[model samples]
Target: MKIGLVCPYSLGTPGGVQNHVRDLAEALLARGHQVSVLAPVDDNEAPPYVVSAGHAVGVPYNGSVARVTFGPRTAARVRSWLADGAFDVVHVHEPMTPSASIIALWAGDGPFVATFHTWQVRSRAMSAAAGLLRPALEKLDARIAVSENARSMMVQHIGGEAVVIPNGLYTKRFAGRIRPDWQGSDGTISFLGRMDEPRKGLGVLLSAVPRLVAERPGLKVLVAGTGQADDVRRSLPSSCRDNVLFLGEIDDAARADMLTGSDVYVAPHLGGESFGIVLLEAMAAGAPVLASDLAAFRQVLDGGRLGELFEPGNATALADQALRLLGSIDERDKLRATGLSAVLRYDWDALIDEILAVYDLVAR
Candidate 1:
């Protein structure tokens, strides 16, 4: 089937939704389906469009603070695609913000299948926009959520039963050789995500790092993502500077390599992490996992059966857990073994097939 993916967020960029759309598009294409992604191009990747800036936490990146922009010209491009009706189905990810997907809702003349990936937590403007968009989303033939948290949010707003279809990863990307640069001092753990949101808990993670390294002198941290790296840089003590490396906005391949090389992966997101896609990538990369104490994360981790667990924001607790985790080489290997086993269920082919199944049911 020809699928037109409509996401307003800037892709070709470093982000969860962008990666999800790109991976799914690639997977669907491999399966002999025609797929086109409609998102503003933010980074130096294939497709070129607007640079939808992002939100700022405590520091500014580049020359600007952070904002996502979609002007009239991009809308013209999207409208042209919609009018062409070149797709058999329309796939919309993140049904809120940037206005492109909202416009597509009206412009596209095909069966629509959408996935809501976030829980309902946002600015009043975003929330209000979502309230307006929910009715239109309900009109879509197929609706799926990446997590149960997302499902409840969709139900609360859209008044429809939404299937839970978790986001997927290309297992091969994470299974490859470790990158040379990613190798840390003695033993290193890493965290990957946008650090601007308090939900990411970079603060919580940083707070834990000093404590962990205090006990385990060899412990190092590598943070790779597209947020305000400065805040983290400033907050980290002078002693921990050498141990913490900040790589701003890496592509999927480099991220996978980093994951493969790391001894452990940490995602101490305190709140608003509806689905931890990074955890899947880490697991796919054969790294043992550590993450937030959220139900969604637990569900993603299969109840700590696949990875280690820690308190959300308590640095001391996280540090103790990280140290305890590092000491358990056998335990980490077992967790890695378990993660590798469970990651099979998240293959892109299977996930795309399941999404198509949802479309079939919805269209019926």
Candidate 2:
């Protein structure tokens, strides 16, 4: 099968949708199918399978910055790619957003599928524009949501029932990449997300860190993602400043190693999480999980069966949960063992057939 995957964001940046598209394309290629990715390119080098449509400009949307390509030149490039690619099926991530995905959805004549990734907070602008966007959305041969919360949001805003197909993770990639140098001696709590992004609740984690480090001596907090590290450090209390290590941005291998070596992986997002891919990655890497009690996080954590959950944005609650988990080695081992077993469901091997089934249904 010749598959074309369209992404709205810049492939250069670390983002959920961009990562999903890249991994999905790789999984397809590994399964003896031809796969090509159409997306915006910034500083990153484009791989052979990637077709760069245009450069993306960062725009604030849904609580974080989305690097998106728009305007006439990009639209023309997208049209050209669609006409020349001759794909069997085009899968567009965030299909409604103004980028290569939407352009491909509008200009392409062949079968297409849209996977909605957002569980949007109520927005008057989205409500008002739904009528205008409905026709283009309905044109999708099949619609998918990464979680039930995302499916509900689509129904509320766009009036449609979408099939639920959760995101896939490369479990094997994370299972064994343990860098000895990256592992710290103390119990480490790792947070992997944009520190400046409010929805990710990095501030909440920062608030919890002071108490966490004081109670458990030699405790280290690893902040591993894109953000202004200096700003984060200066804002921290003087006493616990040395306890936090801001690894500004890390590559995939380092990220996997961090999760593998850490005692606990904390996802402190307040809301707006459609699915928990990072949480799944941590689970696959043998990190005991600690997440906010959001609906989407609950869906991925299976009501805290695999790991632990705390009230979102409450520093005291987060600190208490982290401290408790850090104190007992047995409890931590149990969580890690349970999470590792549960996360195998998300491995690409288990999910590729389901995605291919969707392609078959739409392409026929």
Q: Taking the tens digit of each residue's C-alpha lDDT, what string does model 2 give over 1-364?
A: 8898999999998888988888898889999998989899986687889988889998877878899998888889988888888889989999767778877866787698889998877678877776666767767888889999999888889886888989989897886555555555558889999887898999999988878877876787889988899988999999999888888899888888889988889999998889989999999999999999999999999999987999998989999988888888999999999999999999888888888999999883
Question: Candidate 1, which segments miss by more than 4 Å at Cα?
Answer: 47-75, 121-131, 179-181, 184-186, 227-231, 361-364
Misplaced by over 4 Å in model 2 are 176-186
RMSD of 2: 1.4
User: TM-score for model 2?
Assistant: 0.96
lDDT of 1: 0.73
Model 1 scores a TM of 0.87
Instruction: Give each model's whole-structure lDDT.
Output: 0.73, 0.87
> How many clashes (backbone atoms < 3 Å, residues ≥3 apart in a chain or on different chains) does model 1 have?
2
